[model samples]
Target: MSVFAGHRLTCIRGQRVVFRDLSFEVNAGGLLLLVGANGSGKTSLLRLMAGLLAPAAGVICWDGDDVRRDAETFRGVMRYVGHLDAVKPALTVAEHLRFWAALQIAPGSPAQPEVTTALEAFGIAHLAELPGRFLSAGQRRRLALARLLLVPARLWLLDEPRTALDTAAVARLDAAIADHRRTGGVVVLSSHAGERPPEATVLNLDDFAAAATEAWGWREAW
Candidate 1:
């Protein structure tokens, strides 16, 4: 099985240090639930893991190579769903899915059936013809999220993915996570309290913060 590990990660924002000396690991078929209060660096950590933001210190490694060294390869294997719903307002839902799916596939790829399945799972199959501008907040979120299944990603880095999803849609998302894990995929998702699945690892950013603070206190005392 494959492994992804972040060793002694440090995140700094402007003049403030958000977090430091944080380490976490996720194995293939494992789920990592990121739990923390607001401004606790959960989003920053996810973005860092996605290779969107560079960590001030430490390394995120997939297998053995540092992800930052080959961000493109890391990105190819990852599906990062952030808070923003990045969609084209002029494109219909199906077109959006098709366009994204094609980019991830080779030339002359067959029609993607998962696009329809994802739309159905998100309960937006009926709105597949609707433009992005016509969709409600929840619908837009679902549409953005459905793109995950359209592409094959070994690592899923989700930032508050359940936001704007209905109860039924949440259930579907959970099921999808389970299926992904069963197929030996790794998932890291951030939530306030963190809704965990079976055999999932939990990372509390507060623990890291407290540990960093405690270490600073010890150094000062000594």
Candidate 2:
């Protein structure tokens, strides 16, 4: 099944138009990479797919339903991790996972064990009690990613997911994404980093640069 289908999506920021008439389908078990130079609307497109930002035109369908019409339902089936960690500095690693799991409305009875297993899978179980503010940048990134394992979401919209990570952390992220794809989860991510798995389909934003200019009628900024 197609987890996400976007048709002629257009987004405008101020006088500059970003994407124009962009269309793509991400099926279950598929991994898609969005590659572009800085300020090329990669993040805007990701946000549109995540249902965080509405497109100025066209439709984004998630699991056969219009995301704009049924945002709550669409949100229930997807998870989004942006460039920032979104962790509460006062909370511990375990607390952060539990908090996000709750927000995702994951089944409460299994939340604790699920959080524990996710931390262990990322090799951060030993730091579970550490406060979010005290953890290193890499550790915080892992904790943000651990939210995915705690709750099973069919779609993942990630922005620069590999930032602030060591070699081992990058390996762990690759393995996690591989595992997700193996289990029929779909991922759409924007990254300037050259760390994507071999199977991912690359969508270069430069191909749409002219379209953006035509749609927005502005000079190229990037």
- Which residue pairs come into collision in candidate 2? none
Best by lDDT: 1
TM-score of 1: 0.88
lDDT (CA) per prediction = 0.84, 0.82
Residue 30, model 2: lDDT of: 90
What RMSD does each model have against the real structure? Answer: 4.2, 3.4
Q: Please, what are the lDDT tens digits per residue for candidate 2 over residues 1-222?
A: 677788888788787777677888888889889998898889998888887788989998887878889777778788888988887889999988887777776333354448888998788999989888898888999988888888788888889988898889888888888899999999998888776667778888766654543545444554
Model 1 ranges with Cα > 4 A deviation:
105-113, 210-222
Taking all chains together, each candidate's TM-score versus the true structure is: 0.88, 0.90
